[model samples]
Target: MGRSGSCLCEAITYQIPESSLMEAVCHCKNCQKQAGSAFSTLAGIKKSDFSLTGKPKLFVDKATDSGASVERYFCENCGSPIYSALPSQPDVIYLKTGTLDDTSDFNPSIHVWAATKQNWVEIDSNMPQLQKQS
Candidate 1:
């Protein structure tokens, strides 16, 4: 079975197969700015396994802590973020899990960019954390 999700306005919708490649929480400053929050919940999905409807506007973010460009996609209608893609990882897209219809199962296995995490955010001691993107 596949999972389904949509943008806030339902203008952009997407579907992914049974499971994702990985799930993580990104605490990078750029991610926080784009998400307008403390962190971004992401699910790594293969491009071939994902399907989408509607067009999303893309913003090429060049100012990243990793020194790599990130392609941020969002709904033009409601301005809801859809996903992000990295040039180095052409086959993978980091889906914004918040857009998922069912996010109850989003268990982030790791936290990236912990060095820049918000001062008020506390992470589990057992969950793997990276000071920077690994």
Candidate 2:
């Protein structure tokens, strides 16, 4: 069986056929604004193993500090973020872990954009962190 997730209103549903290639947390400014939280939990999956059932609206984010465009996809009905696609990495889609039906297995092995992370947010020292994506 695959992993499944849906938007808040259940308007948008998705499935990933296998385990994620990577699990990570992003503390970038634009991700914070879009998630309305300190950070975004992400699961990176291969594009070939992903499937979506509903039409999600896309916002091309061009103001990223990384200087790479990010396509943020969300549910129009509930305004819940679903996933983000990177222009530089077309083979992967970073799913918003909060949307997953069960996140017990979600543990980020890495953290990115640590330089912009909120001071109040304490990151696990055991996990690798990057000041910026290299």
Candidate 3:
């Protein structure tokens, strides 16, 4: 069975593979701002394994620290973030796992852009964290 998730208003829904290539937390400032939280929970899934229902508007972010354009897709009606993809890498799509129907299995093994992580948020000492996504 496919994994399911939806936007805040349910205006947009999605189905992903039973698992993802990677699960990570992004502490980039832009991601934090977009998520309205400390960081963004991301699940990288192959483009071929991802499917969507309803129309999600796209915002192409060009001013990224990594110099890569990020195509952010979201529900226009409810303004809930859905996913993001890099123009340079079209084969992979990063879904906002916060929208997942079941998050009990959402285990993030890595943290990226930790340099910008909020000081108040303490990460587990055992997890691998990077100052940036290099």
Candidate 4:
């Protein structure tokens, strides 16, 4: 069976195929500001694995490193970020893990953009941390 997730208000829903790649936690400034938290947790899944149930507002932001644009989709009603897609990497969509019904089941295998990680936040020491997305 596929994994499912939805926005805080359940206004937007999506699914990821069972074989999708592992989850990741991003400490990039864009992610932090967007999530209003220390980091953003994302599950990488092929575009084919995802489907939207409701209309979401899209905010396109340019990545500092690649200068590529990333389209972030969220529910306008609740301001909950549902997913993000990179224009340069069209095949994958990063689903916001916090929107998942079973968020406890999500484990981040890697933490990226850690150079900007907040000093108050402590991450798992065993997990790999890279300066940028790897």
RMSD of each: 0.7, 0.9, 0.8, 1.6
- How accurate locally is residue 42 in candidate 2, as Cα lDDT from 0 to 100? 97
TM-score of predicted structure 3: 0.97
User: Given candidate 1, what's the lDDT at residue 102?
Assistant: 93
lDDT of 3 by residue, 89-129 (tens): 88999999999999888989999999999999998999999
Candidate 1's TM-score: 0.98
User: If the candidates were sorted by their TM-score against the true structure, best first, what order would they fall in?
Assistant: 1, 3, 2, 4
What would the per-residue lDDT of candidate 2 be over residues 11-102, giving only the tens digit for each residue?
89999865899999999999999999999999999998999999999999999898888999999899999999988899999999999998
lDDT by residue (28-120, candidate 1, tens digit) is 999999899999999999999989999999999999988999999999899888999998999999999999999988889999999999999
Among residues 3 or more apart in sequence or in different chains, the pairs in candidate 3 whose N, CA or C atoms overlap within 3 Å are: none
Candidates ranked by lDDT: 1, 2, 3, 4
Clashes of 3: 0
Candidate 3 weakest lDDT stretch, 10 residues: 61-70
- lDDT of each candidate versus the true structure: 0.94, 0.93, 0.92, 0.85
- What's the alpha carbon RMSD for model 1? 0.7
Best-performing candidate as measured by lDDT: 1
TM-score for each candidate, following the candidate numbering: 0.98, 0.97, 0.97, 0.91
Give the Å error, residue 114, model 3.
0.3
- The prediction achieving the highest TM-score against the true structure is 1
